[model samples]
Target: MDLRIEQAGDRPAIAEVHRSGFGGEHGRTVADLVDALRRDDPGALSLVAVEKREVVGHIMFSRSLLDAPRRLVEVVSLSPLAVRPAWQGRGIGTALVREGLRRVGERGVPLVFLEGDPAYYSRLGFVAAGGEGFRKPSLRIPDVAFQVVRLPAAEPWMTGTFVYSQTFWDYDCVGLR
Candidate 1:
């Protein structure tokens, strides 16, 4: 298995993987989120897992904010992590995430946040953001799933509300269209 930055030509396969990984209507919405981010978020970092020369998994990190009353801190948001159904359980998604976070850290990002399963993300160093004083930007996200992980150079006390990009709200919001 090889992991690398996603290229222009990898979009369709990445979308397919998202669709297959998540399934049904939710899958399509996730895939659409990927596309929207790619088109609208110039700062978004996308990575893919390739095996035998085929794209099988993908992950994205996009610019978000930590909206403290005193400051607006730039952070990255991880979303729509996908490994094809056939590729699940193979660590492809893990590889993509680890590598993606590494690259994001190298760029001087201090924090990363996501809304996901604690059981899964905690192993990856994510903890409940609420406990860390990072408030949820929207009431829509459940407290349990809202997580944050600090980068190598992060200030552990960098507390604030997570502000996701409009692209995230636009694509992921249900019943808002």
Candidate 2:
């Protein structure tokens, strides 16, 4: 499998991965969120895994704000990671995440946040953001699911509320209803 930055041609396949991974209406919602992020967040980072020239997995990290006491800091939020059901157990999702993190960190992002299963993300170096002195943007997001991973650029003073980009709010995808 090949891992690389997502290209324009990859969008459709990426959407299919989300649809297959999430299924039903939730899958469509997540797929729509990916499209909106691509349109609105210029700084957003998106990656994909391709096997046999077909996209098998995708992950996205969008620009977010850390309302720190000292000053506003730029961060990222990982959302709606998806892998085609056929590729689910082959570590395609993990490869996309690891590559995404490495690339985002290279861009000097201090922290990466996401709302996901603790059991899944914990293995990927994420910890409860709330326990790490960060606050979630919404109460609807459970404490356990709001996770963060600090990169080398992170500072001790960078603790604060993580605010997702407006597209997230516009799509009403900030947290579970």
Best by lDDT: 2
lDDT of 1 at 1: 91
Q: Which tens-of-lDDT digit does each residue in 1-177 have in candidate 2?
A: 899989999999999999899999989888999999998987799999999999999999999999999999999999879999988888888888899999999999999999999998899999999999999999999999999999999999999999999989987888897
Highest TM-score: give the candidate number. Answer: 2
- Expressed as tens digits, the lDDT of each residue in 1-177 for candidate 1 is 988889989988998998899889988998998888888888899999999999999999998999876688899999879898887998887888899989999999999999888998998899998998989877777888899989976775688788888988787642222
* lDDT value for model 2: 0.93
- Give the lDDT of residue 48 in candidate 2: 90
Candidate 2 collision pairs:
none
- How close is every model to the real structure, measured as TM-score? 0.93, 0.97
